[model samples]
Target: MKKILLLFILISSVSFGQKKLDKLLNKFNKNNVPYISVDSLASTKAILLDAREEKEFKVSHLEDAILVGFDHFEIAQTIAKLPTDKNAKIVVYCSLGIRSEIVADKLIKEGYTNVFNLYGGIFEWKNKDHQVIDTLGSNTEKVHTFNKDWSKWLKKGKKIY
Candidate 1:
């Protein structure tokens, strides 16, 4: 959709001279789906799922979000944490958004309706001044960049190595 792509461009374009995020625009999803925005997410009643690795997750994540992880993701594990109502609204996200799309796709196939991928993941979320919490559930400016290259996309957070 134009709105999603435009928002993606607006968000990804924020980092000066950072094309690293732009290069991954179409890398993740083989099948495109509707994306959830940070503003909308702030007011929504959906369950949030973090699709990053455990280490990445520990650095920071959306408050109350459950980590389903990307590399070691187990559908069984996700099922265990999911609400009993299969129709519950769910949003999946990762560092950039690609990996989360993968997770969201799987959720759709599993027949858990009303699933969406967060447009730009935690990077955009924090950029928009949204709060992310650490393991202790404390508010943190620290965010796990995943690596040196990916760290450039984050502007407002204290980048964690």
Candidate 2:
């Protein structure tokens, strides 16, 4: 009975936390671009794009994720990196998905039909135990949280500023 109670409590807390995150994302994102969950992304072969700054990306990123940068994002440069097929699946992510929405929108404007914003971004990816790689392509738990304020979202992994 004690074990069941503990399990229920743990499940409840996790669910509550996810609800809070959903509320936060809803507040910031325009919802113009569709969001793909971390689990959903894991089973797919999309082109992963990191929308964070170069410094943040160096700390850790999803495997095969290309850094496109958010602050100085250039459509021309980004397009050059993308495949000629506009329908190709592309997923953009940042610390917590806010910045990625902006980047995803840009891709849509540029005629990419299959662009998706990572629902909870890198923070969620690491929170879900997905592997992240450092600059050397070695798996690491360290993730750039963007700032101390945003670091709270990361439930697992070594938080890097």
Candidate 3:
């Protein structure tokens, strides 16, 4: 009986762990990320972070978003550069929302008061017909298409570039 209960708990935890992110995402404004929209993001003074690789980031990214590239070194530098306000609002996103989710958890653990993970990352934003500005070598907003066939679930509506 104890073994059965343990197994059930394990299964429940595994099944529901991701849902925590859903709630976290909803705690902020909406439209772009799950919890926060682009307009809301613009108005709420949240810091935007793009966790993609440097090469991919060079292709395109959200306007005014800081690039951290999901590496330990990059994350450290990014954190160091952040303002001293522990309660500042932060929005982190990566391709398909995986890395951003992980980063959000890390931020929370590190004493950040308000953190949000963009639910679908830039992929969903473009699909929703939202604009994405790029800030890198060239300052041009490009359509952030998920360049893979399996990404169909991410693209729901119009495309942007």
List the candidates' TM-scores in order: 0.84, 0.97, 0.64
Would you list the rank order by TM-score, best first?
2, 1, 3
Each model's total of backbone clashes: 0, 0, 9
What are the RMSDs of all candidates, in order? 6.1, 0.8, 11.7
lDDT of each: 0.85, 0.95, 0.64
lDDT of model number 1 = 0.85
lDDT of 1 by residue, 84-139 (tens): 89899999988878889988888888888899888778988998899999999999
Instruction: Let me know the TM-score candidate 1 reaches against the reference structure.
Output: 0.84
Clashes by residue pair, model 1: none
lDDT of 3: 0.64
Better of 1 and 2 by TM-score: 2
User: For candidate 2, lDDT tens digit of each residue in 1-161?
Assistant: 99999999999998999999989999998999999999999999999999999999999999999999999999999999999999999999999999999999999999999999999999999999999999999999999999999999999999988
**Candidate 3 positional error at 65, Å:** 0.5
Cα lDDT for residue 86, model 2?
100
Q: Given candidate 3, what's the lDDT at residue 74?
A: 51
Q: Candidate 3's residue-wise lDDT over 1-161, tens digit each?
A: 99999999988964574465455445532433235554466556778888777765766677778888776535567788677897888998776576676777777778887888776577656555566655444544454444554244344433332
Model 2, C-alpha of 32: deviation from truth (Å): 0.9
So what's the TM-score on candidate 3?
A: 0.64
